[model samples]
Target: MSSLHTLLVIASLVIGGMAGMLYQKRRNEAENIKLNKTAEDIMSRARKEADEIVKEGKLESKDLVYKGKQELDREVKEKKKELSQQEKRLIQKEEAIDNKMSSIEKKEEQVARKNQEAEDKLKSVDKVREEAENLRNNMINEIEKIATMTREEAKQLLVSELLEDAKIEAARELREIEEQTKSEADKKARSIIATAVQRCAPEYVGEISVSVVNLPNDEMKGRIIGREGRNIRTFESVTGVDIIVDDTPEAVILSSYDPYRREIAKMTLERLITDGRIHPARIEELQDKCKQELDKHVLEVGEQTLFDLGVHGVHKEITKLIGRLKYRTSYGQNVLGHSIEVARICGTMAAELGLNEKIAKRAGLLHDIGKAIDYESEGSHTEIGLEVAKKYKEDWRVLNAIASHHGEEEFKCVESVLVQSADAISASRPGARREVLESYLKRLENLEEIANSFDGVSKCYAIQAGREVRIVVEPDKVNDERLVTLSKDISKKIEEELTYPGQIRVTVIREARSVGYAK
Candidate 1:
């Protein structure tokens, strides 16, 4: 029984220990439950946080997608806008070009309309003119019919009479033309001659063959001879004047072509003889004295010429120069005298014709003034005279006359032409002047050249100082038709080619004389 009891106490002790351990374990388990609760709450919180994170991620994703879509839409709109603007610009450019084209087409249409209008007007006018012409012809026909028979018959009868009248009218027309031309030519010629003759007056040239050098006595001849003619030889060589020591007592002869030089030499010899000197120095002295005397005489002569000419307003220097004209000759006529005659004629003619006498007179005076110094001037006499007149304060018209007097220039004024005519008249008068042999031959040669230019012309001769050109045509070659043509042609050619005093009559003859055999 004791053993059983110990066993039961041991069991109870063991139970008590087990029960305490169980209680402790239960408490620990409750603490563990609370800890588990806390753990669960932490886990729930973590789950919620995770859920919130997912929601936040979804929201961000949605926002990003929306922003991307919006950006995509905005890009589409920008592209559309650009395209629209480009299309609009293209339309605008096309419209502008179309507008320009339309404007150009309108302008072209307007021009065409104007051209059509002008053409229509011209056609209308042409129709009116045609109608007028027709009406005129019809009127002429009706008027003829009213006179008597049929229109053609009456017109023919009237036309026959009219044709006869027209023949006479034609003849009168040509005759009237001839008369008018002649009258005009005469008037022009008269005008020219009148002007030239009025202005100039010149000294006439006289024959002076012998120039006398009077000696004081017969004893002076011995001094002049110098015992061997040495003085005479020296004098002749120095002066170019022939010293004729002759038996005619107390007088010596001076001969030379140049009359001024002869006079100078004569004066020189007279001075030497009077001075009674025989040396070369004395000869020179006498020559100088003679030259001085000649100068004075020349001036005196010029003054005298001016007085004789009735010319005034000349410079003294010019007057002195004009004095030299007394020694000058043109075609063997005294140039000074010719000038004077021309001046007088021009003056007289101008007075009669009621023209400018002063201009005429001036022109006539200076017309031949160039010849005075023409050799020294080295130009045409007309040109020289022109220059001289210009220098002498002459009128421009007078200068023109001086130049045109020789056809050196075209005559500007009537006075210029007048001067030329008077000069021609004065020169052309019988024995007015002489022509050189060479000139005569050359004139004949020119005549031949002129005649030979004509077809079938055989020969030509210039006679009476080119006053006539006789043309002989070959009878076999020149027909009557050709003869008339040749005559007209020759006359026209002569008129163009020749410069002479008077109108040259071109005589063209065509003789058809056959040389038959004697048998």
Candidate 2:
């Protein structure tokens, strides 16, 4: 019974354990089924949410596509509108171009027709001219036969008679015209000249190249001529001037051909006389100082001249040359003063004549620039003035005025003529220039002699202050042609033999005598 009971217990235990394991496996299967069901439900819920999200995204994509389509349609409409406008503009331009082309074609046709008509008219004119020429030749032949003289001889005889008659008639007419014009012209010219002269009257003074310095005493001369004249020699050599220590009470003369040098020497000597330092070193120092001062003064004078003339834009070099005219003289008249007078006269005349006043004044002011450099340069003042004008690149009119003022060149304009006239007036004005009385008398005598030397001149008189020579020719010896020839010869001889400022007028007078005593 104990063995059996033990066996039963073992069997019961095996069966109980098998039963427990079976129960545990069944519970595990039940839990696995619950977990799988939960998993399925969760997957179904996730799938529904995903489906809703995909639907929403599809709707949004459809809306976006619709908006994009609307925008593309609007852009297409605008493009079409722009293309239509461009086409319309192109059509209008094409139509206008075509119209212009048609108008040009019509004009060309009209011109062609007119050209053809002109050609026809020219042809008719040529035909008429041929016929007229034939008629003229026939008439000439008939006239030659009737007259019993050759055409050339007849022509010569007719021409001679016509010339004689024409000459007398022309002379009468010319005299009448001259008389008529001369009065008006003379009055106008006199008014202009008088007004110009009255307006611009410069002071008349003779400019000399010598500078006179007053000394403290005659003893100063001794000191100046120190130690065998060493001081005087040194001063002369340094200053390029002659220091004359003559017996002229209390004055010494500083002489130099160059006015600038003389001025420098004068200033140096004056400083030396004042400072009581008369030595070579002090002279050189003072000379240098005086030169600087003189340079400043020259520029100032140049500026003042331009200012007075109301002229601007002159080259500095030209202005400097103008200033140097202050020291230059022509026939004892100050060149600078004469230039200023000429400028004023030119300005006044230009105003009256309706020309550029500034340019006229500028030309007049610079007309004598060559004289300023004539000592250094080798040419007449006119030629030198031309060179200066060219160097400074002045206007062509100004250059012409300068070159022609002295008759060295041809007048290019009326302004040049005016300049010449003004120059003559200024130079020939009384008291404006001076010459030795002996020279003046010699010139007049020479003029009379020149006129007398000409053939057929019975008597000659130099009148108008030697500016004119009147000749009384014998009518028997001199015909009208011969009188003109004689006058020309006399004028030529005077030009070749005499040198006078301005020009001399040669007048030949011939009077025929038909005095039969009518008792």
Candidate 3:
């Protein structure tokens, strides 16, 4: 305790003196902490005031820091709210876009399936058509017994053989198909003729009335009879006509099958009555003069008409004979008018079928040329016409047409067939020529009345010049099977009750065509 304590006391005194000096230095350093001059100028205050301001600034800093921190917190909260709203809106937009995309994808898939189905159906249809074509070719090849024969040859021979049989069978099987099919086929064929007729309506729709003369005074007619009455006999013999003095107002009765002869006789009688000269010499002179004039006029008219029709290479004598047809009537119909109408109809129909329209027209025009010569020839009109056409240097097709019009020979070309069809159509068309007016009306009325007499029949149209009768039945009253029965019944009734030309077809129409809209 004596030495250790003495050394500790000396060390403590020395350490205490150093501590005091350090304390003094710290105090002086503390005093040196004045306001920075730069701060004083920036803050615009004295040094002491700057110091106070610094202290106040430190307090204000604390408050400002706290306020700033609160504002930052509020901003972060608002930003989060905005971000949440934006996220919600983005999610809705994404969902809407996805729905639209899904809908488009579904539509695309459906379209793809439908397209594939359509393509498959088209491929199947093509395959079926090809197979049917091949089968037809093979079958045709087998029929001719000549393995090397082409399909065309085999088909031609088969057609030639089956034509007659098919015609009979088709007539028999008219009731074997649905009435709709029959009606459609009839309509197609009728449409061709009707359209041709209607489109090219002939300009001449007029008819002529025959003239019969009556004497002005019956007493004068007896005086005109010479002694022994040889004058009347000679007059009749020279004129080739019958002269009758009837109780007429101011005319003499003139009757003759030949209008030209009747006209000549009428003119001669008028000249005798005017000049008071009734003698055989005068009669002979008048007859010769009238004959010459008539001949000349007939020739001129014939030549003019032939030129107008553009008929080529007609013999002068043939043209004169053709002109003579103007005076003649076939059952009260104008043969020339019939021929022209036939030509027009044939041309139009042939054009529609992509055939030679000019040839068809030419054939049709010449079809009745034989009728002009038939009066002098021995054969039928068809044969005469064929020979005449050939004599006139007509085409072979035209010659065939003329020959085949009355079924005198087989048609060689399609144009011949068309001409025949046109001729038949023209002859059969309403108002084309005169028939027994009473019989025609009676037949038409009978056709309708007969159809109406059948059960389940609502209406009937006599078509194809009474060749066919289309009967309509109430859909509710008659079903498809009964429609066929009704048609058969009506056809039987027509045969039993009505008199008609050619064969009469009884058609019953039943239709079912569906219409729909795509979604």
Positional deviation of residue 467's Cα in model 2 after best superposition, in angstroms: 4.4
Q: After superposition, how far is residue 342 of candidate 2 from its true place, in Å?
A: 0.2
lDDT, model 3, position 105: 100
Question: Which stretches in model 2 have alpha-carbon errors above 4 Å?
Answer: 1-183, 436-446, 458-519
Per-candidate total of colliding backbone pairs: 19, 0, 7
In model 2, the clashing pairs are none
| Residue range with the least summed lDDT across 10 consecutive positions in model 3 | 203-212
Each candidate: RMSD to true structure? 25.4, 10.4, 32.4
lDDT of 2 at 215: 93
Residue 51 lDDT (model 3): 92
Give me candidate 3's TM-score against the actual structure. Answer: 0.49
Q: How much does candidate 2 score in TM-score? A: 0.64
- Summarize candidate 2's per-residue lDDT along 291-410 as a digit string, tens digits: 889888888899999998999999998888888889888877888988888899999998987889999999889889888889888878889988999998998989999988867789
Judged by TM-score relative to the true structure, which candidate is superior, 1 or 2?
A: 2
lDDT per residue for candidate 1 within 1-519, as digits (tens), equals 999999999999999999999999999999999999999999999999999999999999999999999999999999999999999999999999999999999999999999999999999999999999999989987886686567678778889999999999999999999999999988976665545444444433444545888878888877877757777777887777887878989887888766566778877887776667776667777788888877787788778876776777877766766676666665567766777787778777766667898778767877777766676669877777778788878888888888777666888987776676677667764456665567666866887798888778787886645666788888898877887778788878767886554356677788876687986
